[model samples]
Target: MASRSSSAAAIGRAARSSGLPRRNRRRVRRLCNMAGPDLMKTKLYSVSPPVKAKATNASLSGPTRYSPGMSTSRGRASRHKKTFPVPPAPREFQQARSRATYERILAAALELYAEQGFHATQTPDIAERAGMSVGGLYRYFRDKHQIFRELVHRGLEQNRQAQDRMLAAAEAGLVAGETDLHRAIEGVVDWTWKALHPTPPDLLRTLAAMAYLDPAFAELTEQYDRYERKALSRLLAKLTSRKRVPSPLAAARLLDLVVPNVGIWTALHPDEARGVKEATVEMIYRYLADPPE
Candidate 1:
């Protein structure tokens, strides 16, 4: 009986000691659960605590430097050449958007041609100014010369129109108290001034200089001069009486020499050519009214 009791007491003591460790372990698990997922995972795994924390941090931290193969904010690279954008044409035309295109091209060409000489003014430069391709410019004009010809024609036509108005005003009795001869001379001078004063003085100068080089240019210039002379001659013929009527050819030649030559001089040497206007009208008056002694 004594031996059996002693064995039972030994067993009871072993159970109490084991139950104490299990109760302590359960309490530890409860505390870890209260501390949150991080603590719970750290406690559940016998891992080095910091190693588990670091792994958890990495997993929860979204994308960052350590992420696999991340993309950056830099722009895409292109394979083709970089091209410039073409600008809109300077002038707009209603009748011929195409005609407007041509005029815009011619306008730009004339500006460049005046600023820089004909040889220097390339179609590419003009095309750049017009905001078009060189190929597109060719569709409108065959060559630079062709464009020049048209520009001159347009300018001359504009001058002719203004002359027509002046003549009408004269016939309606609006002269500035001058003789019919002086009135005719005044018309010529006024038209010449308007022509010379256009935006680019160089264009007309270049045209005149080019005439010496190119026969076609020479012919074109002659046509314009002939138109001027013809207009003057017609005016003189209308104004002069049967007896005093000066020769139309002579009068035209004289007026042409007086007015255009003055413009040419002024264009060539703007500094030396002041008072051209008043001086020209005075000279014309003296040449016409007071014959050379």
Candidate 2:
């Protein structure tokens, strides 16, 4: 009994010294009292393992050390979180979708640029007009400049195609001997007037402004001018056998200016469009038939 009391007393002292709470100390004392001396020693030793004091100075003097294969919160988050790659769409579907998106973005950009001017227009405005997000717009165009380039190029291509078709029709008419000088002259004037006036005045004004500021636009304009001049020269060659003007090339150039001018005049004076068209056709036919001194 005395030996058991001694053991219980020792455990109580040890528990208190080890910073155990008073309640825990009393519990340990009761447990120790219930056991034999040898059992009490084993139970006490098993319950109270030796606790090494933490090296506080190690933390104060150096950087925190983590065990090998351990990761920090940031590192763990990065390791577990991944960005999955986007799978590519099927070839045909991808191509069709791309072409459709390209056209939509181009059309939207053209309308916005025409309305707002190139410098004043933004990508978001274009995307919204096209019914897409800004990021979706970027999938087709790298920037607004790219969109502008594509829009100008697309317009130039459409103009080229229209001119080609008109030239082909004129060539066919000439070969068939179905178009006389009067009809040919009238056709040329009517076509030129329609082409120039089809585009809105504000859109033409925007293009003119852009041509001044952008070298690409200027170059495109020059290319189109060259093409028109060439086509007009070809048409004139087929129409006139005699050199009615000082130079056929000069005549073509002059007619180009005169045709567009008549179109602009008609636009400014819509009520006089018929009179202007007839008068302009007469002037061009007379000039082709008889050269001015």
Candidate 3:
């Protein structure tokens, strides 16, 4: 009975040893199946090396190395970081723009000065109305008077242009030998009267005020008045010579009556000038249009 028992024990031990290898092989096969087809196509009993912690961390630290889905997210972040470019300014401009700006500023200042009167209108007010800096305004003009001087110069030039045209027309009539001296006198009177009446009332008043306010300005005013008289006297002389009108000097003096009186009356009493303008025009007409007896 002891011998039989020993043989049975040896057989049992061999069966146990044989079954252990088969069970381990089946576990490895299932693991390869879970790893997918790439692992399956390789050696069925193959064993890979264990991953090192340092190598895994080094891969994560590098720029290119990333997890399965993380590479796409990082690429998107890189694309978003790119910046858009900006545009540049122009290289050059002309002095014409500056001249235009100056003219605009001057016009705005004049219109404001005319509306409010010079003393009441401020430089800052002019700058604001002109859409310019007050500092910039001073750079161009020293004071309101300087700006006024420019305005006066411009106005005088405009007046001179108009007078030239009118004189041309008058001279043409003379060359045609316009026979009726009375009709010619009436035509001259009308033309001269219209020209005098068109001077801006506020600018004229401001000039008159300057004579009383500033002695230096009063001298400048005298010079301009002299220039005006000379111009008028020259033109009147031409008119008198053309007509062969008798007492030519006296007739020229009569022609000069409208301007000085209007200016003087306006300076002394502005309200009175409105009334005198019409009356004076009539008076001059009567004197000039009448035939010498």
Candidate 4:
């Protein structure tokens, strides 16, 4: 009995050594009891090295290493961004004073330009007349040409405003059943003659010369001419029927030519200025009243 027990125990030990399950080891024991220890002795076994589990750390998986020069997410965004300069706002008083200075400069330049003529006038002369340093004058206007351009622009603007007011008054008068061509011609001629009377012949000649010489002045003169023509056309349309004068544009052009020459003739010959104006009014009225064959 002791010997049989020892044999079964040896078989179970061998099965366990072979990496068999507990149930399989029991079955092997049973089989060993039946088949004896001879099978167990025939099996060969070898030992394997034990594997150690790696140690897990929460801090090791937490974050990457931070270098000295490395920036944070927000800092990195700001580092590559560009900044721009903002201009200071102009004050109201400063702007007003600037405008006053500009007007004063322009007035002085016009006087100098009128006295010395545009081509003969110098920047130093303009600055002295303006009662400002050359540098101060330059702050308002770049050069003599620029000053002349401004003067021309101012004169043109004034003339345009005057013409517009006159046209409006004429339009109002026409709407109120006033249709006397002779009276209208007299009023227009007198107004234009007076406007041109203040302007010196030298200044007028200088302006005319610039209109021919300078491209800038030529463009300005053309613009003023177009404006005047349009205003005249409006006035003519009110006075005459479309059937009688098919194109007011043509009539306006002819009238424009007559008026300026009259103004120039009157300006040159002040002694006969009134007679020239009355004759101009009569001639223009007659031309409009009786169309040429």
Tens-digit per-residue lDDT, 222-289, candidate 1 = 66667667866766676654444458668778877768778777777677666877788878676556
Clashing pairs in 3: none
Candidate number with the higher TM-score (1 or 3): 1
Candidate 3 lDDT score at position 216: 42
Sort by TM-score, top down from the best: 4, 2, 1, 3
lDDT of each: 0.60, 0.68, 0.55, 0.69
**Predicted structure 2: lDDT:** 0.68
User: Highest lDDT among the candidates is held by which one?
Assistant: 4
lDDT of 2 by residue, 1-293 (tens): 79877877777777778655577678776776666578655643644533433221111112223432233554334333422122223224357778888888888887887687777887799999999999998877767776776555556666777878877888898899887777878877877777777776667777766667644456556767777888878778767766466466777888877887668767756889998888888888888885555
User: Residue 101 of model 4: what lDDT?
Assistant: 84
RMSD versus native structure for model 2? 24.8
List TM-score per model, in order.
Answer: 0.58, 0.61, 0.51, 0.64
- TM-score pick, better of 3 and 4: 4
- Model 3 spans with C-alpha error above 4 angstroms: 1-93, 179-189, 196-200, 215-224, 238-254, 260-282, 289-293
Q: Which prediction has the highest TM-score against the true structure?
A: 4
Going through the candidates in the order shown, the clash numbers are 0, 0, 0, 0
lDDT of 2 at 99: 83
lDDT of 1 at 51: 15
Q: Give lDDT tens digits, candidate 3, residues 118-209.
A: 77777788888889999988867766655665665565455556766765666677678762444555555555556555556676676567
Score candidate 1 by lDDT.
0.60
lDDT of 1 at 188: 66
Give the lDDT of residue 205 in candidate 3.
Answer: 73
